[model samples]
Target: MTSLERVSISIEKRLLTRLEKLIKSSRYTNRSEFIRDMIRSKLVEQDWANERREVIGTITLIYDHHRRELSEKLTDIQHDHHDEVLASTHVHIAHDRCAEMIMVKGRVDRVRALADRLHREKGVLHAELSMSATGDSLR
Candidate 1:
Protein backbone atom coordinates (compact mmCIF):
# COMPACT_ATOMS: atom_id res chain seq x y z
CA MET A 1 0.00 0.00 0.00
CA THR A 2 1.11 3.58 -0.63
CA SER A 3 1.98 5.84 2.26
CA LEU A 4 -0.87 8.05 3.43
CA GLU A 5 -0.80 11.80 3.75
CA ARG A 6 -3.16 13.97 5.76
CA VAL A 7 -4.60 17.18 4.39
CA SER A 8 -7.41 19.51 5.32
CA ILE A 9 -9.58 21.99 3.50
CA SER A 10 -12.29 24.42 4.45
CA ILE A 11 -15.78 24.43 3.00
CA GLU A 12 -19.09 26.10 3.75
CA LYS A 13 -21.19 24.32 6.34
CA ARG A 14 -24.03 23.71 3.91
CA LEU A 15 -21.72 22.07 1.37
CA LEU A 16 -20.12 19.90 4.06
CA THR A 17 -23.56 18.72 5.15
CA ARG A 18 -24.40 17.82 1.54
CA LEU A 19 -21.14 15.92 1.21
CA GLU A 20 -21.93 13.88 4.28
CA LYS A 21 -25.36 13.09 2.91
CA LEU A 22 -23.86 11.99 -0.39
CA ILE A 23 -21.41 9.73 1.40
CA LYS A 24 -24.20 8.09 3.42
CA SER A 25 -26.45 7.62 0.39
CA SER A 26 -23.58 6.19 -1.65
CA ARG A 27 -22.83 3.61 1.09
CA TYR A 28 -19.24 4.78 1.43
CA THR A 29 -17.51 3.81 4.65
CA ASN A 30 -15.91 7.21 5.07
CA ARG A 31 -15.18 10.54 3.41
CA SER A 32 -11.58 9.77 2.51
CA GLU A 33 -12.38 6.84 0.22
CA PHE A 34 -15.29 8.74 -1.28
CA ILE A 35 -13.12 11.72 -2.09
CA ARG A 36 -10.44 9.49 -3.59
CA ASP A 37 -12.96 7.84 -5.89
CA MET A 38 -14.45 11.17 -6.88
CA ILE A 39 -11.00 12.42 -7.89
CA ARG A 40 -10.39 9.25 -9.88
CA SER A 41 -13.69 9.70 -11.67
CA LYS A 42 -12.68 13.22 -12.64
CA LEU A 43 -9.37 11.94 -13.94
CA VAL A 44 -11.15 9.40 -16.14
CA GLU A 45 -13.38 12.14 -17.53
CA GLN A 46 -10.34 14.24 -18.33
CA ASP A 47 -8.68 11.35 -20.09
CA TRP A 48 -11.77 10.77 -22.24
CA ALA A 49 -12.04 14.46 -23.12
CA ASN A 50 -8.54 14.37 -24.60
CA GLU A 51 -9.06 12.65 -27.96
CA ARG A 52 -5.47 11.47 -28.36
CA ARG A 53 -5.39 9.67 -25.02
CA GLU A 54 -6.01 5.92 -24.98
CA VAL A 55 -9.03 5.02 -22.84
CA ILE A 56 -11.48 2.22 -22.21
CA GLY A 57 -15.26 2.16 -22.30
CA THR A 58 -18.33 0.19 -23.25
CA ILE A 59 -21.15 0.77 -25.70
CA THR A 60 -24.57 -0.64 -24.98
CA LEU A 61 -27.22 -0.89 -27.69
CA ILE A 62 -30.80 -2.02 -27.92
CA TYR A 63 -32.48 -2.68 -31.24
CA ASP A 64 -35.16 -4.60 -33.03
CA HIS A 65 -33.79 -7.82 -34.49
CA HIS A 66 -36.61 -7.92 -37.01
CA ARG A 67 -35.32 -4.83 -38.81
CA ARG A 68 -33.88 -6.00 -42.10
CA GLU A 69 -30.09 -5.73 -42.45
CA LEU A 70 -29.68 -4.05 -39.08
CA SER A 71 -27.69 -6.88 -37.51
CA GLU A 72 -25.53 -7.16 -40.58
CA LYS A 73 -24.71 -3.48 -40.49
CA LEU A 74 -23.78 -3.58 -36.82
CA THR A 75 -21.56 -6.62 -37.34
CA ASP A 76 -19.86 -4.99 -40.28
CA ILE A 77 -19.10 -1.87 -38.28
CA GLN A 78 -17.61 -3.90 -35.45
CA HIS A 79 -15.49 -5.87 -37.89
CA ASP A 80 -14.26 -2.69 -39.49
CA HIS A 81 -12.97 -1.51 -36.11
CA HIS A 82 -11.85 -4.86 -34.79
CA ASP A 83 -8.72 -3.37 -33.22
CA GLU A 84 -10.74 -1.19 -30.85
CA VAL A 85 -13.48 -3.73 -30.09
CA LEU A 86 -12.08 -5.89 -27.28
CA ALA A 87 -15.15 -8.04 -26.75
CA SER A 88 -18.90 -8.10 -27.27
CA THR A 89 -21.95 -9.83 -25.92
CA HIS A 90 -25.45 -10.04 -27.39
CA VAL A 91 -28.68 -10.97 -25.72
CA HIS A 92 -32.14 -11.74 -27.03
CA ILE A 93 -34.28 -9.44 -24.94
CA ALA A 94 -37.57 -10.55 -26.46
CA HIS A 95 -39.05 -11.98 -29.62
CA ASP A 96 -38.06 -8.94 -31.61
CA ARG A 97 -35.72 -6.92 -29.40
CA CYS A 98 -32.04 -7.53 -28.72
CA ALA A 99 -29.37 -5.99 -26.53
CA GLU A 100 -25.63 -5.73 -27.15
CA MET A 101 -22.69 -4.53 -25.10
CA ILE A 102 -19.29 -3.99 -26.65
CA MET A 103 -16.10 -3.46 -24.66
CA VAL A 104 -13.65 -1.14 -26.41
CA LYS A 105 -10.24 0.37 -25.74
CA GLY A 106 -8.42 2.83 -27.99
CA ARG A 107 -7.93 6.53 -28.67
CA VAL A 108 -10.93 8.48 -27.40
CA ASP A 109 -11.88 9.70 -30.86
CA ARG A 110 -11.93 6.21 -32.36
CA VAL A 111 -14.03 4.82 -29.54
CA ARG A 112 -16.48 7.68 -29.81
CA ALA A 113 -16.74 7.18 -33.56
CA LEU A 114 -17.53 3.48 -33.11
CA ALA A 115 -20.23 4.30 -30.59
CA ASP A 116 -21.72 6.96 -32.88
CA ARG A 117 -21.78 4.58 -35.79
CA LEU A 118 -23.67 2.02 -33.73
CA HIS A 119 -26.05 4.62 -32.36
CA ARG A 120 -26.99 5.94 -35.80
CA GLU A 121 -28.16 2.61 -37.14
CA LYS A 122 -31.76 2.62 -38.37
CA GLY A 123 -33.03 -0.06 -35.96
CA VAL A 124 -31.15 1.05 -32.85
CA LEU A 125 -33.80 1.82 -30.24
CA HIS A 126 -31.36 3.05 -27.64
CA ALA A 127 -27.60 3.40 -27.14
CA GLU A 128 -25.26 4.55 -24.41
CA LEU A 129 -21.52 5.04 -24.19
CA SER A 130 -20.03 4.46 -20.75
CA MET A 131 -16.59 6.05 -20.45
CA SER A 132 -13.90 4.61 -18.22
CA ALA A 133 -10.15 4.63 -17.63
CA THR A 134 -7.47 2.34 -18.98
CA GLY A 135 -6.01 2.22 -15.37
CA ASP A 136 -2.72 3.76 -16.46
CA SER A 137 -3.85 7.17 -15.26
CA LEU A 138 -5.69 6.04 -12.14
CA ARG A 139 -2.75 4.83 -10.10
Candidate 2:
Protein backbone atom coordinates (compact mmCIF):
# COMPACT_ATOMS: atom_id res chain seq x y z
CA MET A 1 0.00 0.00 0.00
CA THR A 2 1.14 3.55 -0.69
CA SER A 3 1.72 5.83 2.24
CA LEU A 4 -0.32 9.00 2.57
CA GLU A 5 1.32 12.36 3.00
CA ARG A 6 -0.02 15.13 5.18
CA VAL A 7 0.10 18.54 3.58
CA SER A 8 -1.34 22.03 3.86
CA ILE A 9 -2.68 24.45 1.26
CA SER A 10 -3.71 28.07 1.30
CA ILE A 11 -6.67 29.43 -0.65
CA GLU A 12 -8.68 32.64 -0.74
CA LYS A 13 -11.78 32.72 1.44
CA ARG A 14 -14.16 32.95 -1.51
CA LEU A 15 -12.58 30.00 -3.25
CA LEU A 16 -12.72 27.92 -0.08
CA THR A 17 -16.42 28.60 0.35
CA ARG A 18 -17.05 27.67 -3.27
CA LEU A 19 -15.08 24.48 -2.81
CA GLU A 20 -17.07 23.57 0.27
CA LYS A 21 -20.35 24.14 -1.51
CA LEU A 22 -19.24 22.07 -4.47
CA ILE A 23 -18.19 19.25 -2.16
CA LYS A 24 -21.46 19.28 -0.26
CA SER A 25 -23.57 19.31 -3.41
CA SER A 26 -21.50 16.50 -4.85
CA ARG A 27 -22.11 14.47 -1.66
CA TYR A 28 -18.50 14.00 -0.72
CA THR A 29 -17.98 13.42 3.01
CA ASN A 30 -14.56 14.99 3.20
CA ARG A 31 -12.40 17.54 1.38
CA SER A 32 -9.36 15.26 0.99
CA GLU A 33 -11.20 12.58 -0.96
CA PHE A 34 -12.91 15.08 -3.21
CA ILE A 35 -9.63 16.83 -3.88
CA ARG A 36 -7.97 13.52 -4.68
CA ASP A 37 -10.66 12.62 -7.22
CA MET A 38 -10.46 16.07 -8.79
CA ILE A 39 -6.71 15.63 -9.17
CA ARG A 40 -7.19 12.20 -10.74
CA SER A 41 -9.75 13.56 -13.18
CA LYS A 42 -7.25 16.24 -14.21
CA LEU A 43 -4.63 13.53 -14.71
CA VAL A 44 -6.97 11.62 -17.02
CA GLU A 45 -7.45 14.78 -19.09
CA GLN A 46 -3.70 15.23 -19.24
CA ASP A 47 -3.26 11.68 -20.49
CA TRP A 48 -5.69 12.28 -23.34
CA ALA A 49 -4.02 15.60 -24.19
CA ASN A 50 -0.77 13.78 -24.90
CA GLU A 51 -1.47 12.19 -28.28
CA ARG A 52 0.73 9.14 -27.79
CA ARG A 53 -0.78 8.08 -24.45
CA GLU A 54 -2.75 4.81 -24.41
CA VAL A 55 -6.21 5.78 -23.24
CA ILE A 56 -9.72 4.36 -23.20
CA GLY A 57 -13.05 6.01 -24.06
CA THR A 58 -16.51 5.51 -25.47
CA ILE A 59 -17.98 6.89 -28.68
CA THR A 60 -21.73 7.28 -28.47
CA LEU A 61 -23.75 7.92 -31.60
CA ILE A 62 -27.41 8.61 -32.31
CA TYR A 63 -28.55 8.25 -35.87
CA ASP A 64 -31.42 7.44 -38.18
CA HIS A 65 -31.54 3.72 -38.79
CA HIS A 66 -33.23 4.19 -42.16
CA ARG A 67 -30.44 6.28 -43.63
CA ARG A 68 -28.79 4.72 -46.65
CA GLU A 69 -25.40 3.08 -46.04
CA LEU A 70 -24.80 4.74 -42.67
CA SER A 71 -24.59 1.58 -40.64
CA GLU A 72 -22.24 0.02 -43.15
CA LYS A 73 -20.07 3.12 -43.25
CA LEU A 74 -19.79 3.24 -39.46
CA THR A 75 -18.97 -0.45 -39.46
CA ASP A 76 -16.22 0.10 -41.98
CA ILE A 77 -14.70 2.84 -39.86
CA GLN A 78 -14.71 0.60 -36.80
CA HIS A 79 -13.18 -2.23 -38.81
CA ASP A 80 -10.45 0.12 -39.96
CA HIS A 81 -9.62 0.79 -36.32
CA HIS A 82 -10.24 -2.75 -35.13
CA ASP A 83 -7.20 -2.66 -32.88
CA GLU A 84 -8.69 0.26 -30.89
CA VAL A 85 -12.25 -1.03 -30.67
CA LEU A 86 -12.89 -3.20 -27.68
CA ALA A 87 -16.62 -3.67 -28.21
CA SER A 88 -19.70 -1.92 -29.52
CA THR A 89 -23.38 -2.15 -28.67
CA HIS A 90 -26.25 -1.04 -30.89
CA VAL A 91 -29.88 -0.63 -29.90
CA HIS A 92 -33.02 0.68 -31.43
CA ILE A 93 -33.93 3.94 -29.74
CA ALA A 94 -37.15 4.19 -31.73
CA HIS A 95 -38.74 2.82 -34.88
CA ASP A 96 -36.59 5.05 -37.07
CA ARG A 97 -33.61 5.90 -34.86
CA CYS A 98 -30.75 3.92 -33.33
CA ALA A 99 -27.98 4.44 -30.81
CA GLU A 100 -24.49 2.97 -30.74
CA MET A 101 -21.97 2.93 -27.88
CA ILE A 102 -18.50 1.81 -28.79
CA MET A 103 -15.78 1.19 -26.18
CA VAL A 104 -12.27 1.78 -27.46
CA LYS A 105 -8.76 1.66 -26.01
CA GLY A 106 -5.78 2.99 -27.93
CA ARG A 107 -3.59 6.01 -28.66
CA VAL A 108 -5.37 9.35 -28.29
CA ASP A 109 -4.95 10.39 -31.94
CA ARG A 110 -6.38 7.18 -33.37
CA VAL A 111 -9.33 7.23 -30.99
CA ARG A 112 -10.13 10.88 -31.79
CA ALA A 113 -9.83 10.10 -35.49
CA LEU A 114 -12.31 7.26 -35.14
CA ALA A 115 -14.80 9.55 -33.38
CA ASP A 116 -14.37 12.25 -36.05
CA ARG A 117 -14.91 9.75 -38.85
CA LEU A 118 -18.08 8.41 -37.25
CA HIS A 119 -19.35 11.91 -36.50
CA ARG A 120 -18.82 13.21 -40.04
CA GLU A 121 -21.00 10.55 -41.65
CA LYS A 122 -24.12 11.98 -43.32
CA GLY A 123 -26.82 10.55 -41.06
CA VAL A 124 -25.42 10.69 -37.55
CA LEU A 125 -27.65 12.99 -35.54
CA HIS A 126 -25.38 13.18 -32.52
CA ALA A 127 -21.92 11.93 -31.67
CA GLU A 128 -19.91 12.31 -28.46
CA LEU A 129 -16.57 10.95 -27.37
CA SER A 130 -16.28 10.45 -23.61
CA MET A 131 -12.61 10.27 -22.78
CA SER A 132 -11.23 8.04 -20.01
CA ALA A 133 -8.21 6.07 -18.88
CA THR A 134 -7.08 2.46 -18.35
CA GLY A 135 -6.64 3.04 -14.53
CA ASP A 136 -2.94 2.28 -14.39
CA SER A 137 -2.08 5.96 -14.19
CA LEU A 138 -4.82 6.69 -11.68
CA ARG A 139 -3.49 4.11 -9.26
Candidate 3:
Protein backbone atom coordinates (compact mmCIF):
# COMPACT_ATOMS: atom_id res chain seq x y z
CA MET A 1 0.00 0.00 0.00
CA THR A 2 1.12 3.57 -0.67
CA SER A 3 1.96 5.83 2.21
CA LEU A 4 -0.69 8.41 3.08
CA GLU A 5 -0.42 12.00 4.16
CA ARG A 6 -2.89 14.47 5.66
CA VAL A 7 -3.21 18.14 4.74
CA SER A 8 -5.68 20.93 5.15
CA ILE A 9 -6.47 24.23 3.49
CA SER A 10 -8.81 27.13 3.96
CA ILE A 11 -11.53 28.17 1.54
CA GLU A 12 -14.28 30.76 1.39
CA LYS A 13 -17.55 29.74 3.04
CA ARG A 14 -19.55 29.99 -0.20
CA LEU A 15 -17.12 27.78 -2.09
CA LEU A 16 -17.09 25.28 0.71
CA THR A 17 -20.88 25.14 0.66
CA ARG A 18 -20.83 24.51 -3.06
CA LEU A 19 -18.27 21.74 -2.62
CA GLU A 20 -20.42 20.12 0.03
CA LYS A 21 -23.44 20.25 -2.26
CA LEU A 22 -21.45 18.74 -5.11
CA ILE A 23 -20.26 15.93 -2.88
CA LYS A 24 -23.76 15.17 -1.66
CA SER A 25 -25.34 15.35 -5.07
CA SER A 26 -22.71 13.06 -6.49
CA ARG A 27 -23.36 10.61 -3.64
CA TYR A 28 -19.78 10.60 -2.43
CA THR A 29 -19.60 9.24 1.08
CA ASN A 30 -16.90 11.71 2.03
CA ARG A 31 -14.85 14.66 0.83
CA SER A 32 -11.47 12.94 0.46
CA GLU A 33 -12.50 10.78 -2.50
CA PHE A 34 -14.06 13.76 -4.26
CA ILE A 35 -10.96 15.88 -3.72
CA ARG A 36 -8.74 13.06 -4.94
CA ASP A 37 -10.69 12.80 -8.18
CA MET A 38 -10.65 16.58 -8.62
CA ILE A 39 -6.89 16.54 -8.27
CA ARG A 40 -6.52 13.67 -10.73
CA SER A 41 -8.69 15.47 -13.28
CA LYS A 42 -6.55 18.60 -13.06
CA LEU A 43 -3.40 16.54 -13.41
CA VAL A 44 -4.68 14.92 -16.58
CA GLU A 45 -5.46 18.36 -17.98
CA GLN A 46 -1.96 19.50 -17.16
CA ASP A 47 -0.45 16.46 -18.84
CA TRP A 48 -2.24 17.18 -22.13
CA ALA A 49 -1.23 20.84 -21.99
CA ASN A 50 2.35 19.83 -22.62
CA GLU A 51 2.43 19.10 -26.33
CA ARG A 52 5.29 16.64 -26.17
CA ARG A 53 3.76 14.59 -23.40
CA GLU A 54 2.49 11.10 -24.19
CA VAL A 55 -1.28 10.98 -23.96
CA ILE A 56 -4.25 8.81 -24.81
CA GLY A 57 -7.54 9.88 -26.28
CA THR A 58 -10.57 8.62 -28.13
CA ILE A 59 -12.10 10.41 -31.07
CA THR A 60 -15.75 9.65 -31.59
CA LEU A 61 -17.39 10.54 -34.88
CA ILE A 62 -20.88 10.24 -36.26
CA TYR A 63 -21.50 10.69 -39.94
CA ASP A 64 -23.72 9.84 -42.86
CA HIS A 65 -22.08 6.86 -44.55
CA HIS A 66 -24.27 7.52 -47.60
CA ARG A 67 -22.38 10.74 -48.29
CA ARG A 68 -20.32 10.33 -51.42
CA GLU A 69 -16.78 9.11 -50.68
CA LEU A 70 -16.93 10.04 -47.01
CA SER A 71 -16.09 6.59 -45.69
CA GLU A 72 -13.06 6.33 -47.95
CA LYS A 73 -11.84 9.72 -46.88
CA LEU A 74 -12.11 8.80 -43.23
CA THR A 75 -10.29 5.54 -43.81
CA ASP A 76 -7.47 7.32 -45.61
CA ILE A 77 -7.09 9.77 -42.75
CA GLN A 78 -6.82 6.91 -40.26
CA HIS A 79 -4.23 5.15 -42.38
CA ASP A 80 -2.19 8.34 -42.53
CA HIS A 81 -1.87 8.19 -38.74
CA HIS A 82 -1.73 4.44 -38.40
CA ASP A 83 1.33 4.51 -36.15
CA GLU A 84 -0.41 6.59 -33.52
CA VAL A 85 -3.86 5.05 -33.69
CA LEU A 86 -4.14 2.14 -31.26
CA ALA A 87 -7.45 0.78 -32.54
CA SER A 88 -10.75 1.78 -34.02
CA THR A 89 -14.30 0.49 -34.27
CA HIS A 90 -17.11 1.39 -36.61
CA VAL A 91 -20.80 0.83 -36.08
CA HIS A 92 -23.63 1.15 -38.55
CA ILE A 93 -26.06 3.43 -36.82
CA ALA A 94 -28.65 3.24 -39.57
CA HIS A 95 -28.97 2.67 -43.28
CA ASP A 96 -27.37 6.02 -43.87
CA ARG A 97 -25.53 6.86 -40.65
CA CYS A 98 -22.41 5.40 -39.01
CA ALA A 99 -20.45 5.95 -35.81
CA GLU A 100 -16.74 5.49 -35.30
CA MET A 101 -14.59 5.48 -32.20
CA ILE A 102 -10.86 5.68 -32.76
CA MET A 103 -8.52 5.04 -29.83
CA VAL A 104 -5.26 6.96 -30.14
CA LYS A 105 -2.04 7.11 -28.15
CA GLY A 106 0.73 9.55 -28.98
CA ARG A 107 2.06 13.03 -28.32
CA VAL A 108 -0.61 15.61 -27.51
CA ASP A 109 -0.20 17.58 -30.73
CA ARG A 110 -0.33 14.50 -32.94
CA VAL A 111 -3.44 13.22 -31.24
CA ARG A 112 -5.11 16.61 -31.48
CA ALA A 113 -4.21 16.93 -35.14
CA LEU A 114 -5.62 13.53 -35.95
CA ALA A 115 -8.84 14.40 -34.13
CA ASP A 116 -9.09 17.70 -36.01
CA ARG A 117 -8.63 16.01 -39.35
CA LEU A 118 -11.28 13.45 -38.59
CA HIS A 119 -13.68 16.13 -37.35
CA ARG A 120 -13.18 18.39 -40.38
CA GLU A 121 -14.14 15.74 -42.92
CA LYS A 122 -17.28 16.94 -44.71
CA GLY A 123 -19.73 14.20 -43.79
CA VAL A 124 -18.91 14.06 -40.06
CA LEU A 125 -22.08 15.12 -38.24
CA HIS A 126 -20.41 15.24 -34.83
CA ALA A 127 -16.98 14.58 -33.32
CA GLU A 128 -15.62 14.62 -29.80
CA LEU A 129 -12.11 14.08 -28.40
CA SER A 130 -11.94 12.54 -24.96
CA MET A 131 -8.46 13.16 -23.54
CA SER A 132 -6.68 11.07 -20.93
CA ALA A 133 -3.16 10.14 -19.82
CA THR A 134 -0.70 7.25 -19.80
CA GLY A 135 -1.11 7.07 -15.97
CA ASP A 136 2.60 7.27 -15.22
CA SER A 137 2.21 10.09 -12.68
CA LEU A 138 -1.11 9.50 -11.00
CA ARG A 139 0.62 8.25 -7.86
Give the candidate number with the greatest TM-score: 1
In candidate 2, how many Å is residue 25 off? 1.4
Measured on C-alpha atoms, candidate 1 has an lDDT of: 0.96
Which of the predicted structures, 1 or 2, would earn the higher lDDT when compared with the native? 2
Candidate 2 local lDDT, 25-111, one digit each (tens): 999999999999999999999999999999999999999999998999999999999999999999999999999999999999999
| lDDT at position 38, candidate 3 | 90
Candidate 3, residue 104: lDDT? 96
Q: What is the C-alpha RMSD of each candidate to the true structure, in Å?
A: 0.7, 0.9, 1.0
Error of 2 at 5 (Å): 1.4
The prediction achieving the highest lDDT against the true structure is 2
Give every collision pair in model 1. none
Tell me the lDDT of candidate 3. 0.94
Residue 60, model 2: Cα distance from true site in angstroms: 0.6
TM per prediction? 0.98, 0.96, 0.95
Tell me the deviation in Å of residue 104 in model 2: 0.3
- For 1-139, candidate 3 gives per-residue lDDT tens digits of 9876899999999999999999999999989999999999999999999999999989999999889999899999999999789999999989999999999999999999999999999989999999988998687
